[model samples]
Target: MKEKWRLLITEKNSAYRNMAMDRAELVSISKGNTPPTVRFFTWKPRAISIGYFQSLEDEVNLDACKNLGVDYVRRITGGGAVFHDKELTYSIVIPESHSQVSKNIMESYGRICGAIIKGLKQLEIDSSYIPINDIIADGKKISGNAQTRKAKTVLQHGTILMDVDVEEMFSLLLVPNEKIRDKMISDVKQRVTSIKHILGKDISFNQIADAMRIGFEEEFNIELNKGILTDEEIELTNKFEKEFFSTKEWNHRR
Candidate 1:
């Protein structure tokens, strides 16, 4: 059996640094320089992150994001755009050869997201995994995840909604048509929920992190020893942030 996984509770950071670090960790793990890692982090100044294949203009209101001081970045993983405010984000990197990491995407989502569902359950929030990459409670989405595989390493990261600001989210994210924006907002309100909504009160970030930690430990039967980013990952992240995530060429590639 594999030994303890590395767990990092990182300080809040800019959108560019967060995404850069995620890819850096993946690179480090793939090269056998770091252990499988689980990292929990938050965004500073709030942010919106889009998937690798998304069209920046088509999916986001760049002017609104800039005007409101909300940072935006493109993830290396493929998925829809996500508003990252009032949420806890987690990223896990494991090699393909790990017993817990599955070869199939759906199967991998099932196993990785199971830890999320289990964690939510610990909070008295009854939730289930909806295929592809979502966790739902009372038939509404409470979490969304995305994954990318590279160099025989899998990087899976997701958002755990602490609160949902439909209006703010809509302001920064584009609707299919301006005319139907209201309807879209209404639909999203009905379909999405958060920890505060389910629990009917605010939950501290550390509280949620603790629950998630136990969930992963219990579900995967692997201890997550607290750790920090290695020197190699930090170096890579610094380089990638400047060359990739901080550049318009990468974010607006589409």
Candidate 2:
């Protein structure tokens, strides 16, 4: 019999709620209230999430986000700003002491990203993990991930782009001037890629989720039993959303 883990396939939500749920799962697993979990989710109305160490005003164009009706939030994990649209975002919460988890951050990243690479292969896309935390296909980035460990637990979450809009993404991010902005957008278009771009067709989210589910199971040698959030997790999610992710104090904190 294979080791069993919880799997959560959630609907689209605001940036705040998404970040909150990831943190909630981290907290729940750390407290031994829930099994280690793998969760996949998306953003509704679109959003921008900045790294924990980032300054919101420096990284995001608040006026543009407001005008475009895109939500903005700060994540507990460290990474650059990410525009969340047309992507399947995944999070895994596991004990740091789990047999498969390495204390070395780089090694841990490589192991978890192997699962993502396998998932992409199932979609017929050849991809590889770039050191630090990125997945590239055909020399262009298709996924970006970030990880944080707390209370003896590991929480890693990342985005797998289904499609990308360089122009729209640049519109919501801060850039020095029009000249620099235009050049930066051009540069990113060359660097970033997505499933639609790679496969030359649109793929449904369910299909991607299913592929990732199998990828994780195969890489970890575990059975992922589809599951729902516990009541305590739900309560924590609400608290985190209200107190941290959705608050200006948290989002604006450098």
Q: How many angstroms is residue 101 displaced in model 1 relative to the true structure, after the best TM-score fit?
A: 1.0
Q: RMSDs, each prediction?
A: 1.0, 0.8
- lDDT per residue, candidate 2, 121-158, as tens digits? 99999999998899999999999999999999999999
Q: Rate the local accuracy (lDDT) of all candidates.
A: 0.93, 0.94
TM-score of each: 0.98, 0.98
Best by lDDT: 2
Instruction: Name the runs in model 1 displaced over 4 angstroms.
Output: none
Clashing pairs in 1: none
Model 2 steric clash total: 0
Q: lDDT (0-100) at residue 86 of candidate 2?
A: 96
lDDT of 1 by residue, 52-92 (tens): 99999899999999999999999999999999999889999
C-alpha RMSD in Å of predicted model 2 compared with the true structure: 0.8
- Segments of candidate 2 deviating more than 4 angstroms: none
